[model samples]
Target: MDSFSHAFIIAIPLLLAGNAVLVPFAVIGAVIPDIDGVFFLFPDDEPSRYIFTHGGITHSIAGASLLSLVAFIGLYLLSGISWFSRFFPEGVTMMAGLAILAGAMLHILIDYLAYPGIPLFWPFSTEKFTLGIFPGPSLMILILSLGLLTLILTGRAGVRHYKTYLILCLVIFFIYAGIALYANTETEGRAIPTMDPTRWITIVETDECFVVRPYDILYGRGEEISYRKYTNITPDELAGIARLPQVQRLCYHSYIVTAERRGDTVILRDPLREEKVFRYPLDHSSLVIPLQETRSGPLPKNTDRP
Candidate 1:
């Protein structure tokens, strides 16, 4: 989810509950996990850079907890200052900290439920877990959230009606999710949601190739648009390529990668980049390494190479 959507979605309930003190803190916490986005500003040429990239440690459970704790300590210390103490009493710091922690957790949960999930157990585990039911930066949700925010700001919808508006928003959100879930049912492989709630993209992996296709909840599956064939490179060669720092980073970030041979080099890239259906802002560039024929004997029979 985008920062605004994260803040507004979390803030709405707090507003309804009338916890004004914790609202700002919680909003801060919700958007702070995205601090890792700064990594995107620089070139992603170095493997070490991926450690700080989006959906990395900052999006993990341990990282979020540490951030919340640091934030709590900061708030606690600030409350001791005379000027700050007048406005933010020391007694409320603990509660505010808890609210911030909850907000951060909520942010992780939202991302986990969306397509191309975060590394929730990062450092310990790099595997991403996602329900793939919601598209990140969902247009529908963003528009609805903005509309609700406008109503609140304009005084057209006050605190008394917050519950009504919130409930309505949730219903619409869930309805879209339900549609996505229905479309994803019995999917061949990973079902990735697109901006359109009714539309999805499926990536099915085979021993020989990776099949990419478009799917729609209302129209059923579409024709195959991409078929990325596995390279004829031997397993030993593949293992060596995987050991390279750059390739390791690429594999860590991309869920479905394809290998292709170009002359004396082998290129590895995420197959999703070939299609326009579901475009994630992740690093989709190819990692090319020189082809090194390390073995002297014939290639393994399981490999597609002759």
Candidate 2:
């Protein structure tokens, strides 16, 4: 799941346990597990600090348990209360620590369904156990966490008033996903033409692509910018495109430049551009042709994204 969704999922339990004031702390606790992956910020760099070690520690059940125990002990001693009394009679710190541990544990559990699974019982075994489904583990986290949050919040009478908002959010999200899926699918789902790391561009049918501005919220959707059929390019040109350093850096494993044929020339369109760029005599697979480039401007239409 996205960060917002992950945080919301962790915050819900804290919200249920404490009031609004504790939500931030709970979110911090939840995000602590992921802090080990700090190298994510410098994805291209090797031997980055915080990547080699500390990844599974905070994310593991054992690590969270240790933190929880430490919190319990620290709270008891700081408050100068008997252990039983601290836990039973006035268990503020203990409960708070448990909330933190719960957040971390939940983070691990969510990552299990992700591509590279987390070690629930670390130190027992170093082997990773993943669900091996989607490559984008964050996406699974986003959907499930948000869904659970919606379900939990829906069950509460006080939050019932916001049910319409939640439903609206879901509807809008699927609408965008539907369009994005359509764009990618219709275009043959190639890596080069369809994948957008920034998610600003979504492939529609061949020769057509839609630009969608991403959202910042858990279930928020983006607005689509439709780029109508423009020009056609040949497979050789697409292959040449795959050789480019920029495209290689961006899409990587999921690159595909799909072309649709028309009349004597194979027309290729730049889905990201406003003007049409054409490619002629689309055949002769050995010939490598350069794709045309164009400038972009403000969209002709306006729509809400975030």
Candidate 3:
């Protein structure tokens, strides 16, 4: 979700409650999860380069909790100083921390529905929980939110107007997202009969890699394909690569959790990026990765699905 959508969506409730001091903190925390992107700006050769992969730890519940605690301490200390006291009300720091926590939690929950889902419960379980329903952001939602924001910030009436617009925005978002999620969920795992013979999901899996075939689903049968993971590498090879922190980080973001053998390279890709598999021109997300260079080997066979 865009920062504004989350900010207005989360902040309005606090505004309506007559605790507008928390609104700024709520908006601040909402965008904090994306700070992981900063790691990509600077260069690092070691595995630490992947230390803060976008949507890795910072998007997790634990990460959010830590940030909330940080916000609490920092703000509370600032409020203690006489210089900052004029701007901050008594107990505002504590309330701001709670607002931060609430906003961040909402951010994570919304992102969990997007493709190649977030590691919300990582360290405990690597399982990616995703609805893969909407595109994760709706322009409609943003527009409605901005309109309601105008109403909340400047209006003829006071609390009554703010409350109405706030409720309206929340209701509209829930209804819009709920419907899309429901539709996608209904279509997700099953292959529904169709007049078209278009392929839905096609993966060529072997003892090694799963080469996800490129196909469109909108024009044809709505079938879902699932696969199991296997690797041709021996225990020794697996152990060596597993030790590399970068490889572990790559695997962490990968939903497919499988590897392929490229030309003298060990390739691992998140199956969710299947559309990029056989593109004539490889894009970044498409040309996902080759874990580490190794012995060149025969490629996997083509296993077409019915």
Candidate 4:
């Protein structure tokens, strides 16, 4: 979710509860997890730095707690300042810290629902878990959030109606989630939501290939859009390639990856992004490694057997 949507969605509950004092703090917390986005400004060539990338450790439970702790301390110290206390008479309290923590957790929850999910247990485990119910970037969400924000800014929507607005947002999210969940059940593999709520992309993995197709909640699954075939690299050779530092970093961020042998090198890429099903920019890009560098020598074309 975008920062705007994250702020508004988190603020709704606080507003409804009349905890207006915590709303600003919570909103700040909501966007704090995204601070890792600054990593994107620099090249991610170092495999050791993967944990610092967007949607990496910061999105994890441990990372969130650490961030919330730092943020809480900052808020606490700021509240002690006489000038700062004048504006926020309530000052920082335990409840304020909890509110910030809650906002950060909510941010993680929202991202978990979207594509190429977060590693909730990062540092401990790099495996990413995603419901794949919502598209990475939803035009619908952006427009609705912006419109609602406009109303609040213009004083057209009063605080009294916050509950009603929250209900509407929940309804829309659930409807989309419900459809995607049902579609996933009917399919063999995962169902990835598209920009259009009604449509989805399904990926069914096989021993040698991954079958990708479009699906519709109202109708049914459509024709195959992509068939990513795995390179016929030997188990030992493939294991060595997987062990490569660069490939390990890519695996940390991508849910599914496909390897293609090209001359003396093997290219690793996320099939979803490679197929353009997930249109949003990804944290990891394709990686190419020379085959001679693996434990085994250059592989024979289309033959894994020694």
Tens-digit per-residue lDDT, 1-306, candidate 4: 888888888988888787899998899789899999898898877886767777778999989889999999998998888888776688888988998999999999988888767878877877777777777755677777888888888889876556666777788788878887788787867677777887887777676677888888788878885556567554455655655666767666554677777788888777666656665446565778897767533222211000
**Per-residue lDDT of 187-305 in model 3, one digit per residue for the tens?**
43312111122323334445544444333444533343444453454434544355344555555444345554454555554555454422211212222334453333332211111
Tens-digit lDDT track for model 1 on 1-306? 778778877787898777877788898789889888887778876785565778778999999988888887887787778888776643446678888899999999888877667777777866667777677666766776677778878879776566765677688668867876677674677677777777777877677676777887777888985555566664455655554556656666565667777788888776564443435544544677786833233222211000
Q: Which parts of model 2 are misplaced by more than 4 Å?
A: 13-22, 39-55, 67-92, 140-306
lDDT of each: 0.71, 0.42, 0.56, 0.75
lDDT of 3: 0.56
Best by lDDT: 4
TM-score of 1: 0.85
Candidate 4 Cα lDDT to native: 0.75
Per-residue alpha-carbon lDDT of candidate 2 for residues 78-99, written as tens digits (9 for 90 to 100): 5565654543343445556666
Candidates 1 and 2: which is better by lDDT? 1
- After TM-score superposition, the amount by which residue 87's alpha carbon in candidate 4 deviates from its true location, in angstroms, is 3.1
Clashes per candidate (backbone, < 3 Å): 0, 17, 0, 0
Candidate 1 error regions (>4 Å)? 90-92, 155-157, 225-229, 274-277, 291-306
Measured over all alpha carbons after superposition, the RMSD of each candidate to the real structure, in angstroms, is: 4.9, 14.7, 7.1, 4.8
Better of 2 and 4 by TM-score: 4
